[model samples]
Target: MPGIHITDIEAAINFWRERRPSADGFTLALPVQALASLYARMVFQRQDLADEQAFSAAAWAAWQTWYASTPDTPCIAICSTSQGDAVCKGCGRTESEVQYWPEMGPAEKRSTWRRITAEGTAWRFNRYAERARETQRSNAGNS
Candidate 1:
């Protein structure tokens, strides 16, 4: 069940839109249209995932384009799974995920990204986030 998540679909749509905005404002680029078609169908069927094997050639090409533009890994440099934690506090990845990430397929990696983002409890989303915000506030106060 290797599939693109709906959020990834939305990202792909945005990517295509930015790369090939409608010239006439009333039409879509072919890549956008192809991905959008799949997006619409997924929405109509209430599916959150687009089956990789089911993608049309055009849609597949479009998705690949978008996928290539994205970061390959979610690592934020900090790792906690190295210290016996089941999940890395930084990236929200399990120890196994950290260890095996380099060998994971695209879909598998994306799936992990989707899960971590949805959970939104990782240090990348919180601890580091708070630190960044504090720095921003401190800088603003200094200014």
Candidate 2:
């Protein structure tokens, strides 16, 4: 089973913190409390990943709630995986990821997103974005 990375937990914590900030500086929002408890345990245990099956009901529920708020995919509608690229130039997803995205779980999708975002090599983040503007400029100049 794919373990939940600590970074994902941290992101979820931040999400809940923003969505449900405590009225007082001392107290945590319910979802934040739930996820924070999990985060605390992970830190205390010195574990970088958490077992999904081991999650407490509240932790799982809190995580699910946070997950729902995140974007589902990183697709910029410029898929290069269609032309047989092992990794998509546009979205920065592996061909397997593109093929199986519909079936991937929230955690799996998030993991892919984390990797792609960290790499920052996707065309959508770089050249492909500039290329679109250039194309528009070319069209405007022609007319």
Candidate 3:
């Protein structure tokens, strides 16, 4: 399984910490502490101090929990695949990926998201990322 990003782990740690003081003696507190420790080891590049399998499992669980609140989709509504393009110029997903998106599992979708973002070849990420961000900011401000 792909590990959560360092930044995400950091965010999760903050999330847990913010709720920790009020969570004393609770079942969730132990897991939250464990997660924080594991995340800290990862951030400091000290994987040797922790079990990799354990860390992966904990991170995956934490990621799933966090992602439930903000499920992301890569579609920017300009799919070139609809016009018979093999790869979408907008989102960089292939025709098959676009067709199977609704059926793809979370891991598969995340893999595609990571690929597109890393490649940075799509119009969404390359040519219009700033514009998209600005638009999102504008929309958020209005809301």
Candidate 4:
């Protein structure tokens, strides 16, 4: 099983909610860095192509096929709950939401996804800001 890319996971979850089949399976139990390595390996495998433009075109086709087969969401938000937060920091979901995630109707689950996406974007921005600040401070000390 190939490690799951973030983009692939998104595509698979979206495709599942939309009731459409993706071109490939995106379910991977590996960590993000591992999945990134897999993606890098896949890109290298296509290095034999002589035509850059043709290769680019094929890459998109390949991605689409892979995205079609990925599995649905796996976020249970347990780590957050364990930290005493009633709602998941990742998905903004309550304990019930996490427990009922699998049994949820498509419409309800999609609504939950919207909240999850919103929270994820916010979390990403905050993380990026923190990293930038840390880098800046480290550079200041070195200069």
Instruction: Note the Cα lDDT for every prediction shown.
Output: 0.89, 0.86, 0.70, 0.48
> How many clashing pairs per prediction, in order?
0, 0, 0, 9
Model 4 residue 22 distance off true place after TM-score fit, in angstroms? 18
Per-residue CA lDDT of candidate 2, range 11-87, in tens? 88898889888898889987788888989999999998788875788889989887888788888888888988899
The candidate that wins on TM-score is 1
What's each prediction's TM-score?
A: 0.87, 0.83, 0.58, 0.34
Give the per-residue lDDT of model 1 (tens digit) for 47-102.
Answer: 99878876789988998988899988888988988888999989899999999999
After superposing candidate 3, which stretches have Cα over 4 Å from the reference?
1-31, 34-61, 133-143
Candidate 4 lDDT, tens digit per residue, 1-143? Answer: 12223345344334443454333555432232233343455467743112212224434344344443533453532347567777766446777877777896433554565556666643323555577689999999999
Please tell me which predicted candidate would have the highest lDDT against the true structure: 1
Q: Model 1 segments beyond 4 Å from truth?
A: 135-143
What TM value does model 4 have? 0.34
Candidate 3 per-residue C-alpha lDDT over 1-143 given as tens digits, one digit per residue, 9 for 90 to 100: 54445555565666765656544454456446667767667757854223335565655576567656555778889999999999999999999999999997655676687688899999988768889788999999999
TM-score result, candidate 3:
0.58
State candidate 2's TM-score.
Answer: 0.83
Give Cα distance to truth, residue 68, candidate 3, Å.
1.8
Return the TM-score for candidate 1, rounded to 2 decimals: 0.87
